[model samples]
Target: MSSSAAGRPDDPVAALAELTEAQRQQAMRRWRLLRPHLEDGVAITRLAAATDASPRTLHRWLTAYRNDGLAGLARRPRADKGRRHFPADLRLLIEGLALREPRASIATVARQAAAVARDQGWPIPSYATVYDIVRRIDPAMATLALDGEKRYRDVFDLVHRRQAERPNQIWQADHTQLDLWVITPAGRPARPWLTVIQDDHSRAIAGYAVNLGAPTALTTALTLRQAIWRKSDPGWHVCGIPEIFHVDHGSDFTSLHLEQVMADLRIRPVFSLPGRPRGRGKVERIFGTVNQMCLSQLPGYAPRGTRDRAGRAQLTLAELDTAIGTFIRTIYNHSPHGETGVPPQQRWESASFIPRMPDSLEQLDLLLLTIAKPRKIHPDGIHFQGLRYLDPILAAYVGDSVVIRYDPRDMAEIRIFHTGHFLCRAICPDLANHTISLKDITAARNARRRDLRAQLRDRASVVDRLIEAHQVPDPMPLPPPAAPAEAPPVRRLKRYREE
Candidate 1:
C-alpha cells in the first residue's frame, strides 16, 4: 500500500500530503513509537519518551484519535491570523482624553468619548471598556479615583493631630475689614480695618486694633506690646507666653520691625503659605463669621468700593478707628462663637493664658517701636503720608535720622519725639481740606447740589402748606435799586427818549 494508505485500519492515513515535510517526519516517528505500545497497552509516558514528546502531546493525540479516529491528529488548517484579545483603538482614545483633562472623572471622560464616537459614526465602547483600558495604560490613574477628596481628608487629619488642648500653645493672628461706619469730620461715611490675635485653644482674642489704614508693622507690634503688658500686670495676675504665633503673609506680619519685636519677645512667628488659605483657616473663618454675622448687619454698611468712591466719600479715618474699638470690645470678645459655645473672654479667663505684663506704658512703647525708614521733614514741617508735624526736639536732629511714632487710627494728631522727649503734637487737616489740590471738589459740589435741591423742595412744600391753611401771603422781597454813579465829566448825558 501507498504511504498515505498504509496506516492502522482504525486510523487510516488522512491528509498526510498537506503536512510540511518536517511535520510529516515527526508524525511518522510518533506513529512508529505508538504502534508497539498499542499492542501491549503501553504507558502513555513511555510512548511520549520514545517519540521525543511531552505527555500533553500524547494526550492531545489520544483525544484526536477518539474524535476523528486519525484525521484530527493531522495538523489543523493553519490559522489565518493571530488572536487579538486587547482592544487597541479604544485604549488610545481613553488615554488621549485622560491626557487632555487630567482632573476629569473617568465616567465623565468615558461619556465624552462615547459622544464623540457616535458623532463620528465610529464604534462606541462601554464605560467598563474605557475603565479597563485606563487601568492597563496607567495604574496610578486607577489609584487616584478622586482629586480633592484626598487633600480634604488630609487636612482634617492634620487638624485633629495639631489641635492644642492648652490656650497658650497656639495663637492665630490676622487682619480683617470691619463694617462699622463712622461719619467723617466732613460728614462722609467711613469704615475701619481691624487686626486681631486670638488664642487657638481658648478662642480668646489676645490683642486687637482698629486703625484708620490697614494695620502696619508698628500697629501690630504696639497691639502685641499692649496685650503682653496687660497679661503681665499685677492687677490682672495673668502670665503665659504662647509657643506658636501664626499669621498670614501680610506686609505687617513680615516686616522687619515686627520680626525684631517677635525676636526680642522670644516668640516664634510662623507664616502661612501664600495662596493657601487653609494654613490660616482658623483666622480666615473667624473673619468670615464676623463679616456675615456682625458686619453685614450694620447700618450704612457698604461693600468696598474703588479708590475714587472712597476718596469722594471723604472716609473718616479717626471715627472709624473708635467704632472698630467698640466692635471688638463690645461685640467680638463678648459674643459667643457657635463652634466654641463660649464667649472669647470667658474662654480666655478659663484657660488662664495671660502673659507677664510690662512695668510701664513707656517701656511697652519702646519695646514695640522698631527701626523704620527715616524720612526727612519737608519745608511744610510734615514728615510722611501728608502728616503735618512739628517737633521742638526734632529741631536739633533736623538733618539727622530720628524715630517717629504715632497711632494709625488718630492720624489727625501725631506725637513727635526726639530721643524719647515729648517734642511736639501736630493736628491733621480738616477732612474737607485734607487733600492738597482740592481733589475733593467733586464731593463738595455734589453735596452743595443735593443741599440746594432739598432746600428748594422744602420751600415749595411750605408754600403749599401756607396756601392750604389760608395764611397771609408773604410778598417776595425785591432787590434795592442800585445807587447812580457820578457822571464822567458830563460825557454820558445822551437821552434816547428825547431824541
Candidate 2:
C-alpha cells in the first residue's frame, strides 16, 4: 500500500468515489475503544489501563476522532466537503439565551429559539443542535442552568469569588414552620414556629428557638444570645462580631430590637431586598432542604390548623420542639452541604479568619441589646399591640420619654425602667389583635378551660372503662344494705350483753 493509502489517503476524488476504502481505519479503531468507556459503569482508569494509554490522551483522541472521523483525524482533506463549523448567528443566539435566561432548560431555550426563528423567518435549530452550539461556544455557560435556580444578584455577588473563610464572618438566619405539633406547658396545642441562625462558614446552627406563634425580635434575640454563648468560651472577649448578619426582611429581623442587638454586638445586620430570597440564598436553600428532607418526612406531622381543613392529627408543642432540636443539631448541621462540599461543623472549625470575641459580659450585653422604640400610651393606659405597660418607677416620667426593654413576643408587658428604677407591670388583652383595653380574656380563659376539659375527659373515660371491665354496679345498693344491717344487729347484741 502506498504511504497516502496507509496514512493520509491522498486521492480526494477517488477517496470520495470509493467511500469506506479510502478513509483512515486507525481513527475508527480509536473511537470504538473510547465510546464504550464513556458509559455509566465503565471506569476511565480501567479503560486506560486496558488500552495502555493515559486517561487524558484517550479522552483527547476520543473527542477528536468522534467529531471528525478517520479522514479528518488523519489530517487529510475530504473530497466533497469543506471544514465543519457552527453558523455564527446560531452560536450568538445560543449564547444570548444562556445569558438572558439562566434558569431556562435546554429544551425550553431551543423552543424559544425556534419560535424566534419562525417569527423572524430564519432557519431554526433543534434543541440538540442548540445544545451543541452552546457547548462549542462556551461549555461553562451550559452548566449555568444546572445550578437549580438563579440566586439573588447581591448574594451571588458576595459568594461568587470567595468561600466562607471563618465562623461569625457571615451568619444566615431564617424562619421555618416546623412539622411537629406541640402541646404547650399550659396544655394548649402550639404550632411552634422555628427560627434558626446558621453560621455560613461552619454550617453550624448557632442558635434556634421554637415559639407558639410567628418569630419575634425577642425570640430572635434570645436565640442569638444562646448561640453566641455556645460558640464563645467563658472568658473569650466578644468584641468584633460577625461582619455580616444576613437575613430576609421579615418583621422580626427588621424590628428595632433586632437592629439594636446586632449594633450592640458590633455585628452588621444585612437585609435582603423585599421579595428577593436570593439575597439570603444560603438560608433559603437550607429552608428548602429542611422542609423537604426533614419536616415533611416526619411522621404524625400536621399542617397548621388554619391551613388544614381536614383536622388531621397534630404533634403537640413539646413534641415538635424536641423534633426540631434533634433535626437542627443532629441532622441539618452535621449533614454535608451540596455547595460547600463539607459538613457545617467542619467548615466552622476550619474558618480561621473570623473576628475576635468581645472582652466582658457587660460589653457583650451592651453589644447585643438595643434601645426599645417609643410609643405613646393610649387612653386605656396601653401601648402598641395592646400591651398595657405601667411603671411605678416611670410615674414621674409617665407621658414622658422612658426607655422600655421588651421582648417582641410579649408586647402585652413592657419592661419599663427610667433612671434605673423598676416599674409596675401592666397586662394587655391580646397583642395579636392589637386591642389594648378590649381585654378579650375570653379566648385565653376558654383555651385554658378547653385544655382542662380535655384532660378531665381523658381521665373520666379511662375510669369508666375500668368500672365497666370490673362489672361494678352503679350504687352497689342491695349488697351495701345487707352489710349495714348485719353490722347494726351485731353491735346491738354486744351492747345488750354488756348491760
Candidate 3:
C-alpha cells in the first residue's frame, strides 16, 4: 500500500454526474456569471446589475466557489426545508385529518382546523401550511390510512423480483387477450388470447399458443407442452423443464392437471399471491413489447378503445399466428433485451448447458396434454362429447374405466390410458377425415341448441295462438258429463305367505 498505489480522492468538480439537471444548470449559470470577474477582473457591482442578482449574493457565491470548488456553486437546499413549527397535538391532528378516509382537500382541512384552533385558543394553520404538512406525510402511511393496506403494499412494499441463475432454472407463463382482432373460421371477427412461456434468465420465449378463445387449463397445458419439447425452429434453442414455474393465480395456472404435470416433471410451481401481479412483471413486460412492436404493424390492430375494430379485421387467425411466430423468431429473439443487454437467444445459449428433456415426445404429451377425462368404454366404443371414438383395442377394454388425453387443436383422435399405461389412440369415425377443434365442437353444439330453443318457442307461440282463437270460455261446464260407469271389483289373491 504505497502512496502511488493508493486511489486518489474524487474531485468534486469532475463528479458532475452526481448532480441533478437543475443543480447542474444552476452551477453552470453561477460559474458563467462569475467567470467574467474571475478571469478578466470585472467588478461585482457591474456584474450584479447585468445579471439582476445583487452584489452581496455574487460575493457569497464567489467565496463558496473558492472554498468548496464547483459543487458549492449550486443552489443550496434549506436546512429546515421540511420541518414545521407547530405544536405536537396540532401536527398530529392535521395529519390525522389528511389520512382520514374520504380524504379532505387542503382548503377544507385548513378551514376545519382553523375553526378548531379558534375554539381551543391555538394558532391557525394557513392553506399553504396545511398543504405542506399533507405533502410531507409519508406516502406509504397516507395510502395505508386512506386507500387501504393492499394499495400500500402494491405501491410501497419491496418486491423480491425472481432471478434465475441459469437458462433452464426458472420459467414464467401468462395469458393475455391480444389487442388485435382477427377473422375466425366462421368468417366472424374475434379477439384471440395468447399464452406464452419464457425462460426467466434469458428473457427468451420458449413457446406460445394463439387461439380465438379464452385461455383455459388446456391452453396452458398445450403451451407448456410446446415449451418443454425441443422446437423445430433452429433459432429457438430454449427447451427443457424448469426448476421453478412462476405464474399468477389464474385458474388455468392453478389447475389440478397442471399441478400434477409439474409434480411429475419435478418442476416447482410458484404462484404469485392473489391480486399481486408484481411477481409476474418479467413475463407481463413481454406482452406489451409484442403489442407495440409486432401487432401494431398488422391489420386489425385494435388496441383498447378502437372504434369498429371488428370491421377492420382482415387477417385470419392462422395468418396472425404465423405473423406472431415470425416476429418472435426474427425480431424479438434476435433483438438485444434492455435488461439483459444481449439477444435472448444468445444469452440462452451462452451458458452452454444441456437442457433437461423428457425421455420422448410421447411421454411429454402424456404429462402435458390439456385435459384427462375418465371414460368407460361402451359396447360400441368410447363416447365423449357426443362423439363416439373407436379402436380395435377398445373392444377388450369395454366396461372398464380409462383416462383419455387429446389435443384440443385436433379432436379426431385421442390417446387412451388404462391403469396408468398407454393403451391406444382411438379415432372418431365422424371426425377422422377432417380436423375439428374442441372449440368448434362446443360452438356448433351451442348454435344447434340455440336454434332448437328458438324453434320450440316459435311453435309453442303458434299453438297458444291457435288454442286462444278456438276457445269458448263459457262452455267449460260440460266436462262434468264425461264420468264413466263403475265395474265390479275382483277377489283379492294373496301372492305371498307369512313364511
lDDT (tens digit, per residue) of candidate 2 on 36-86: 664334666778988877989776765554444344444355674532254
Per-structure clash totals for the candidates: 4, 18, 0
Superposed Cα RMSD, model 3:
20.5
**What are the per-residue Cα lDDT tens digits for candidate 1 across 76-161?**
65585432244455556677776563566779879988987787677787787777666665434433443344544434334422
| Candidate of highest lDDT | 3
Provide the global lDDT of candidate 3 against the true structure: 0.85
Candidate 2 runs further than 4 Å off:
1-26, 29-162, 178-192, 211-219, 231-240, 249-252, 273-275, 302-310, 334-343, 350-401, 408-413, 420-499
Clashing pairs in 1: 232-356, 232-357, 240-354, 412-428
Q: Arrange candidates by lDDT, highest first: which order?
A: 3, 1, 2
Determine which window of 10 residues in candidate 2 has minimal summed lDDT. Answer: 1-10
Q: Which stretches of candidate 3 lie over 4 Å from their true place?
A: 1-79, 186-188, 305-308, 367-371, 434-499
Error of 1 at 172 (Å): 1.2
